[model samples]
Target chain A: MSLKKEGPDPKDWSGYTVGLNFGMSAIVGMLFGLWADSAFGTKPWGVLIGLFMGMVAGFRVMWQATMSNTEELGEKNQTENEAKKTDKTDV
Target chain B: MSLDPLHQFEIHKVYDLSLMGYDISLTNQSIWMLGTSLVLCLLMMVGSLKTAKVPSRMQGFVEVTIDFIQSMVKDTAGKEGLKLLPFVATVFLFIAALNLVGMIPGSFTSTSSLYINGALALTVFVLVWIIGLFKHGFKFFGMFCPAGTPILMMPLIVPLEIISFFARPATLTVRLAANMVAGHVLLKIFAFFCIAMGAFFAVPFIPLLAITALEIFVALLQAYIFTILTCVYLNDALHLH
Candidate 1:
């Protein structure tokens, strides 16, 4: 038995992230459902609008997730460069 | 005509101190936040100490969660940031656990509070700034202003970037708080329908149950969103690009 962690390759982690986003969106949708129900006295109809908002929110999260990974990679490179400079100075 | 739902926000003084100009009121929100913190601490202690060859169901769940966050970091932040695995993993567990715990009946979710989210966001914001400084020195400020913009566009782009940078915490806070408050408010309102529309209508309870389950899913999802966003922010700070 390997001690290594399993499930979800890092490159494809976006998919799971996407699922999480959708789940969150649904929660928001429920809220929207409630708000709309109260405001218009139309119970589930508000939920429909909320669900749409949630979908859009999820997409926003997905967009952020996509950009974040690339940015982290860039920070790591900077760290490496700084380290190299420090080493050269010491030598 | 009805009790203000927002009345729940009221605060009562728990301690009086005249010297420091600080009145420590143990607000309902504060109590809820404390409850969340205690639950998180207990869960951490249990999950961390429980190591087994076969693993109990709870332990298995914990292991799976760790693996999920770890993989997420590696994929987004890359192999270089594998060093931050511990921090990333812990944040994920803590936030996710806190969010999910709120799904329990009669539990108040601290993450749903703007105060809590703001605090968390501030911590992350500070962490990113410090990490960037450590790696890039004063150059870290450049994170607010990306490179390669034309000098003519500098005035517009730079300020816009700065505003966006500042808005990160607000965005994070609103995302978590709005979801929590909204979901619970809906649940409470529907539950009211069960009682208010007279005892004859049992139908509302079914939707309430369904929403409760959905709330559970929301708990986990919000936690995931919080953690993943942290990773993304960490990635940005680390990379400075």
Candidate 2:
């Protein structure tokens, strides 16, 4: 059925990945922190710092994805507007 | 009869072997992986051997799959990224094949295993690091620091960037494995309900069918996501931005 047809655009589909990336990055950060705590015997500090860093990383990833999407959309819109202007002039 | 949804994921050794001190056993996971690879290679060979101007159905399918991945790589990483077309295509097809094969009854989903996914993700991760370093040399570290940043923010920003950079492989591994595990577990639970409902099996059966369809979609989507992310990471390595 639809599987045989062309799939959705990768640009659009890429947006769906942001949430998974954000959550997983945070979990990974916390895991790393937990490992650090065990290695350094720093108890709660490692977890706390790790969680914070992970959250920051997650936010950073989210922000980067947003920025890229916006940039692509903006370029598309600009080209479309330019084409529209040229079409009117030709007419 | 048991309602344990995770029972499907349990690995069992088929042929036990040891290499040096490490246990190199062939399990259901290994078997399914090998089967998927073999089937994929056969399909490709068959598809390519009979290429025509109009193309047969098999050739068309192969062409479409390759075109999809090619465009994805071009879009994410630009023309230079086409250099990685072979690696990117293999990753996509292999992952998608594994996922689709796992949909069959009693088949093992190799991707559901963190160890397998971890290896794949780590390969991509390490490759990105090596490529970035090789291409850009010491300047590769500049990626951690954005183009413009106040000196005051370096301490805070650099560590965060490093954390996120290191988190890529973990994120990649967890995302695919978790999606497969979650989807399969849900499917198993629903199938159990269908059987347990006895005469009213139709009730759960309907939802089970719907979820199975969704799982198929997710299987392909996760593979696409994984490949696209690999392209993105490759882009970053190549361009350092």
Candidate 3:
């Protein structure tokens, strides 16, 4: 009997977390930027820079999440393909 | 009933206490949190009091929960993550219990408070930092810069990476707290509608029941998400890539 587990992969659960992570990263970046500006008296430059950094951070998170998901999918496909090849040889 | 849906989140002082200049008064939030922990402890103790080969219902439950968490840790962080099974299990069970308990009518959801969730997230953040620093030393900083990045891009990438790194705890805290608060407020609003509708109270009652069920699911899901994310962060610390 195969020991392979059934049901959705646990890693798939991480997908639910992406939306919030993206928004929060941007907000946190901007907040940090604002604080830096107030401390250094840079005013608008700080906010602009911070906001940009936050957006970049947000995109980075989305990219990472997408990359990991695709990696998992690739692995799953590889295993399935190998299994199919073995079955074909048996037939 | 109060039409204000957010009224459910108000923290009321149950006992007055102070230390030095700090107000250490016991509030409803603290009481509920304590109650949840105590109940969880009692359940755990009761569930494992007797061991059997065949396994009784309580023993089976305990085993299943631990096994589930163990597999989760293993899957996410690999073999080394199993070392953290007890910690991860405790966190998952505690948050799940707190969220489920909060679903009780008239009970305060301690997790709905930003401060509590913030503290929980910060705990995980500090733990990750300690583990990463201890395990990798100065090499851990290398995580901020991905592999194969040109030196020219480092200036832009480093700050973005740093911001995202710090954002982890913030995201964790906000996600859990916001989910709990939003679910509870939604339930409260629907409940108010069920009462305020008077003649057509049944109209809102159906949706209220559905929302309650959804809230319960969210409670479990949020807890699971929080624990899994903790494991993921721990993975980064353990395996730097």
Winning model by DockQ: 3
Flag regions of model 2 displaced more than 4 Å. A1-14, A31-43, A67-91
Question: Model 3: how far is B238 from its true place, Å?
Answer: 0.4
lDDT comparison, 1 vs 3, better candidate: 3
lDDT of 3 by residue, B178-208 (tens): 9999898888887888778899999999998
Docking quality tier of model 1:
incorrect
Superposed model 3: Cα runs more than 4 Å off: A1-14, A71-91
lDDT string for model 2 (B1-241, tens) is 4578998899999999999989989998998999899999999989889879998999988888888888778888889899999999999999999999999988999999999999999989998989899999999999999879899999989878888888888878988999999999999988888778899999999999999999999999899889988998898898876
lDDT of 2 at A65: 76
Interface RMSD of 3: 4.1
- In candidate 3, list every pair of residues with a backbone clash: none
**lDDT (Cα) of model 1:** 0.69
Superposed model 1: Cα runs more than 4 Å off: A1-91, B1-3, B7-21
Query: CA lDDT of A29 in candidate 1?
Result: 51
Q: For all the predictions, what are the DockQ values?
A: 0.06, 0.36, 0.44
Q: Rank all candidate structures by their lDDT, best first, as comma-separated numbers.
A: 2, 3, 1
Instruction: Write one digit per residue (lDDT tens) for candidate 1, span A1-91.
Output: 2234553333344544454455555565556568779988987777776666555556655675677766766888999999999999999
lDDT of 3 at B24: 92
lDDT of 2 at B36: 93
Q: What fraction of correct interface contacts does each candidate retain?
A: 0.06, 0.43, 0.53
When 1 and 3 are scored with TM-score, the better candidate is: 3
Candidates sorted on TM-score, descending: 3, 2, 1
